[model samples]
Target: MYHESVMLNECLDGLNIRPDGVYVDVTFGGGGHSKAILARLGEKGKLLAFDQDPDAQQNAKLIDDKRFTFIEANFRYIKKYLRLYGIKQVDGILADFGISSHQIDEPTRGFSTRFDGDLDMRMNQKAEVSAFTVINKYPEDQLHKIFGMYGEIKNAKTLASAICSARMNAPIQTTGELKTILEKYAPKFKEFRYFAQVFQAIRIEVNQELEVIQEFLEQTPELLRDTESRLCIMTFHSLEDRLVKNYIKTGNFYGEPQKDIVYGTITKPLDAVSRKPIEASQEELARNNRSRSAKLRIATLSE
Candidate 1:
């Protein structure tokens, strides 16, 4: 499998799909969700999917359905692309965030800690900034911030100093070389988890994943047809889940609502369907280990 869709049925139920409604799958990695959406749609229903990764684009090509149209672009520019296709609004929007299984499994992509590959973790292969650039070119203070903020590593300052000192001897070129440096700073017996956190921080910076998610979420209100329209997002990590949760609650990333001084009304674009995010079932957890950390959040336009 290219990538197993986590919380598949839950996401579909959250979508509340209308048989003839127009929908979008912004992160069409393996097309598992997109294929399922198409199965539930009627003849008039249309499913437009977006992906910037060339590998994902290839996966999309195998689907030969008139109701499906694949857009080879980042989801951050979703509104602009939808307009080009004469689609001002959609009935539902689904986004499955984080790196895909295919990317991690492929050794050359450098997404997995177990694999010794080139330090290149760009979702879009054509992108200039890669993990190599982040590790080699970024300053020590910036590295400290990325490690502490994105990775949540405890020894981030010390790790940053070590990386700078080691790079002074030679440029950190490969994943293995970086891991060698990380091994020295990593906590005893928790080295693997530590390595993953550092790699995740670098990947997030290289792709600007958090920034893209906020931009994509900000556009959802205008794109949704009405209050009936749904927005279902599945995130792998806390950083992602927090953004989704906050935006749904307050229509902002900060989780702070703008109140109308006179009427004491909170001005927000979207409303949460549930107070808490939905987690994967025990059945799914047994089936796919990757689903363990997954969180599904649903929202609709505010009345």
Candidate 2:
């Protein structure tokens, strides 16, 4: 398993799985959560999972359970893929959205700041827009936007300018080369954080994570069964968590949900089961460092 499914027990709690209820693990990275779901299910219970990464496909092969079905595709097409198996609705859906540990540890895929690998941070190896493309080919303004919006970097313009100037001389092909160019802009006291934020911006741009996540969340209303159904999402970043929090509270991804002034109500298909997100317990954090930033939010279909 490349990534330890963060907050396992908590995710299962949010799932509220029934012995025979149908479930979907949208981000079945290591199959930790999927395996757990299966453990709680009856023989008849089914688990349908999706992960586009070839590495994840290899891990999926280790599972011998007939109740599990792995879809070798991105979860953005959740509803479309589920329909292929004659599944219209499921009792629950779980999404653990972020890069896996193996992707970072492998060094070749270039997801970790600690690695000197090539600038290839595509979650799906087949994806065209890699870190190289984002850094070397993207317009200065677009780079600035990605850095600012995705990375939340305060000096986004300066970072973008640095990349543009560096790339003009020669294309930045590797994570090390990109880091060297932006090293001057990195904060002296907090170099690691600066580089992390910068890398995060490029990776997000390369993968179109936020947009894809929004699309995935947008489809949950249709995939989930009414009232009894649950949608559990675990986000590792603020941009993702904010969108999930807002979407569950409001049908739209915008600021505030539209309201019926006369009735004083906002009728959304989903409602937040808990007002705040669930964080990993101290025990889980000690066991796995990756669970530190995980925030699990659960919602259920409304009446």
Candidate 3:
């Protein structure tokens, strides 16, 4: 399915785009945001788009403009890859952390709980790990940690045990098989939500989602070319949003509040663009259920 970008207008406005500026769209799935950025660029402006999934590169529109370049690589290596293009810094960067509709709607790619397909949720198909390895090969204790930390499942221990037990009989290879195993443990009232949580946890572990975010956040300041350079990120879950928000406010994840630090004590490289996260409007939410969980956080590089 064609992937429609979330928070399109809000993100573009957040970037405060300039026609002559260079920008990066880190998650270029379906070219949704990348296309929008191109429309706003002048003949002299440039846009670099990155998507690791090679199939996604096929979606690149036939724009003959020399201003646009598509990079086939995961965004975690964004800094290194950009440097290869002689781009040491950028004017603005936009990242939509939500899984693209292209990945979810394609049952064969297998990102959705609704789809009865192979449990392969790697954002970068080139990645070595897949849901199969995470579920079948990962130690029970590690699985438990992923469920508890990433899924935040209340019955993490039991669920992890259940998965381990089932895999002993046979490998949990597909979404359908995994769902059957999880269904036996899901509470009656919260069955569906619990399954989603458990599956999401597995996906996160398989993809190393949290670690990627940490690396991406740490690399943000180095990418901004000017003092006013912007970082606009759209996150779907509270965990991801928390990382973005905290990173923008404080360069470090866990430390005493920086607001109390004396002058010259330490300088934060980013300045908050909004006091609070921005959410989809009522109209946008009604049209797209995916927009409901979306939260946009913006920050500008400090001088």
Candidate 4:
């Protein structure tokens, strides 16, 4: 199985679907959420889905609906691609971000820390950057920043120095090789957690994920038509979730909402529907282990 989408029912509910409206699934990983969205859409309704992974395209073939159009592209260009198809605005947009289960399960993709594979964690196969390049090629300072900022690893400095010192002998080309070099540093109790964070840091840098997310969020306000139009984003980590939360609340990626000088009122483009992110239900939590980290935040375009 590629992955079961987290909070499937809640995502559909938050969309505030209009049977005939236009919708876009920015992260059409396994097509689980896209199929659900298409079910609610009328014959006249259109659902444009985006996935940069070539593997996802095979999954897209399962849906033969004329209402569905699969775009083999990164969602950072959501507005550009939709415009080519004459979609200046959509009624709703749904994004389920983070690596899919298929990518993690397939050791060849190098996403999982469980099974050793090549040091490659690219979501897009064609992308030039890979985990191998980052580990062996990047300087200690850059690696330190990536681990600290992206992975939120507490001992990022030591980890970065370890990788650099080990790589002086030869390249760390595989997961097993890298893990072996860092063995001494891995905590006795939280070894898996440490490796996962290290791997996540490399993966994010390879994909430029946070930057793409920022670009994607910036486009959402202009993509939706009006107040009734909604944006549903499912984030798997705190960094991405924090960015989404801040953008929704402040209309910018940083700090509080900009204020109007005369009235001292904040100017924002979207009003968050739920003050807190929606978490998975007990039933969902029991089924998918991934939902524990999943956070669904929804907001609507303001008038």
lDDT of 4 at 126: 88
Clash totals in order:
0, 0, 0, 0
| Per-candidate TM-score against the hidden true structure | 0.99, 0.97, 0.95, 0.98
Q: Candidate 1: where are CA atoms >4 Å away? A: none
TM-score of 3: 0.95
Which candidate order results from sorting by lDDT in descending order? 1, 4, 2, 3
Steric clash pairs (candidate 1): none
**In model 3, what is the error at residue 11, expressed in angstroms?**
0.7
Q: Residues 37-139, candidate 3, lDDT per residue (tens digit)?
A: 9999898899999888766778875555689999888788989999999989899999998988768778887788888999788887878899989999989
Clashes of 1: 0
Over the stretch 229-250, how does candidate 2's per-residue lDDT look in tens digits? 8999999988888899889888
In angstroms, the error of model 3 at 136 is 0.6
Best by TM-score: 1
lDDT leader: 1
Give the better candidate number (1 or 4) by lDDT. 1
Error of 1 at 48 (Å): 0.5
